[model samples]
Target: MKLVCTCIGCAIEASCPYSAPRFYLGEGQAWARHFTEDLTRENIVKGLKETNYGRCVYKSDNNVVDHQVVNMEFTGGATATFSMCGFTRHQERRIQIMGTKGEIRGEEGKIKVMDFVTHENTEIQIPEQTSGHGGGDSGIVRSFLKEVCGYNGSEGLTSASASVRSHLMAFAAEQSRLNNGQSIELDDFYKKLLVQV
Candidate 1:
C-alpha cells in the first residue's frame, strides 16, 4: 500500500482564509463559530482579535518551515509520503491511497475511486460545509465527549498510545529532515527519548 498527502497554502493576498485577513478581520470571516458561543459581530471580532488568525505568514517571527516532505514506512511495510507547502495559488489538501485491489484520490472535497479488478471508476463530491474540515471538527468533538462520558468503544476514536506514536513519527520525520534526510529508525528514536527522560 502507498499513500500520499499534501497541504498547500495560498499567497497572502489570495482569497484563502489561511493567509488572508478577511477570514478573521474582514466581512468574509467563515470561522467565527470557533470563537464564542455568541454569534454577535462584536464578540466574534473580539475573539478573533485575541488570536493570531489574521497574521501575515511571510512576516511571522515563528520558526515554521514553509515547505516539507516526509517519507514513512509502516510496520506492515506500507509506504507513505506527506508534504506541506505554503507557496501555492490555493490553500487545499490532497490525498491519494493505493492498495493491491483499488486506489482512491481526493482533493478539495472531491473523491475518486478506481477498482483494479473490474476497472470501475467512481467519483464522489462532498458537500461544502461551514462547520470546518467538512464537519469533521464537530464529529471529533462529539466523539471526545462520548469518551469522556464513559464510552469504552474504540470506534471513531484514536487510542492514546497510537496518537503518541503518530506524534513521535512526526518528530522523527522532522529530525530526519534536519539531518539532511538521513533515515532514522523509529524504535531507536523512541528508546533514545526514553533514555534522555
Candidate 2:
C-alpha cells in the first residue's frame, strides 16, 4: 500500500507528494512518540511549544538509523532480507512469501494466497485488531500471564533463545552500520556481548 500510495502521488503530481513528511516532528510530540500517545490538542500544542526538529535531516544528534537494510544468510544457504525506510507515502507494511507450491502476498490487514498447481487465488481478510501491532502488548501480556499461571510450553514474550538471537542480530546490524557495513559473525558477536555482560 505504501508503495502504491507513493506511486500514485508521483503519477498525479509528478513528484512523490506524501514522501517522508518533510516537516519536523517537534520534541514532546516527536514522530516516534506519536504512535504511543493520544493526539489531544493540548498535547500537540505542548510538543510544539519548545522543540528543535528544524535541523537539517543530514545533520542531527539522533543516533538511530532512519533507513537500513539487514541481510542474513544461514549456514545451509537459506537467506532473508529486511529493509526499512522512513521515507514512505503511508504507514503500511507489505510482504510477499514464495514457496515451491504456492505463494502468499500480504500487508497489515489483508492477504492473498496463490496456488501454483491449481492456479487458484485465495483472499484472506484479517479480523478487526483490538491491540496495537495486531494485538501486540495484549498478546504478550496474556502469554506471560499464562506462563506465570503454569501453562507449559508457552511462547511468553518470545522464547529466551529467540530473544538472544534477535538481540544479537540487532546489535550486529548497528555495529555493522557504524563500521562502514562490515559483516559481523553472529556467534562471535554473541561471545563478545557475553564477555561484556
Candidate 3:
C-alpha cells in the first residue's frame, strides 16, 4: 500500500446553514418528531428548546472547541493529518491520500484518483445519500442486522482490530491536542492505556 501521507478534514460551517429552526421548521420536522416524547408540534418545539438545538450555534453556552488538528505517524513511518473546523461555508468532510503508486482525493461523495505510473486521472461519483451521515448510519445498521442474523455482509464495518486501532488513533490525537500537539507513539500509548485500565 505504501501510503505516504493522508489529510482529512471535517468541517462545520459557521453560516448557521444547519440551524435548528432551519431543520425543525423544514424538512427535518419528521426527524424532530422522532426525538420528541410525543408527536405533538408543541412537545417537539419544547423538547428542542430544552436542549442546545434551539440556540444559535455561535451563541451556544457549550465551550467545547470548534476546531482540532491532529498529526500522526504510523509505525511504518506513513503520516496522516486530520483537522476539524466550524468556519467553512458548508459542512463536509474531505480526504486526500498520497501513496507510492498514486493519490486519491474525495469530497461530497465524489472521488478523484490519479495514478502516477499510468499518468491517468479517474473520477467516481458515489450514489446520492438519502440517509444521515452520507448514508453511513443506515449502512452500518443494515450491516449489523445482517451480521446478527448469521450472515456476514461484505460491506459491513472493518474488522475489530482495525476499528480498535482507528479509535486508538483518535484517542491519541485528542491526547496530543491536549498536550500542545505533542507527537504520540501509538505503541507506547496503547501500552500505557492498557496498564491504566
**Top candidate by TM-score:** 3
Question: For model 1, how does the per-residue alpha-carbon lDDT over 1-197 read when each residue is reduced to its tens digit?
Answer: 62211112334356544543455445445556566667676776566545554344555565867899898888999999999998775567889999999999988888999999999999999888666666668777787787888876665455577778889998998899889999989999999999999
Candidate with more favorable, higher lDDT: 2 or 3: 3
Off by over 4 Å in 1: 1-28, 31-60, 149-156
lDDT of 3 by residue, 50-103 (tens): 654565554445677689888777667898888999767556889999999999
Two-way TM-score contest, 1 vs 2, winner: 2
The estimated TM-scores of all candidates read: 0.69, 0.70, 0.70
Q: Over the full model, what C-alpha lDDT does candidate 2 score relative to the true structure?
A: 0.64
Off by over 4 Å in 2: 1-38, 50-59, 154-157
Ranked by TM-score from best down, the candidates are: 3, 2, 1
What clash pairs does model 2 have? none
Clash count of each predicted structure: 0, 0, 0
Report, for every candidate in turn, its global Cα lDDT versus the true structure.
Answer: 0.72, 0.64, 0.72
lDDT of 1 at 17: 41
For model 2, residues 73-161, the per-residue Cα lDDT tens digits are 87887777888997774556678877889999987688999999999999999876666666556777787777888868746575687
Which residue pairs clash within candidate 1? none
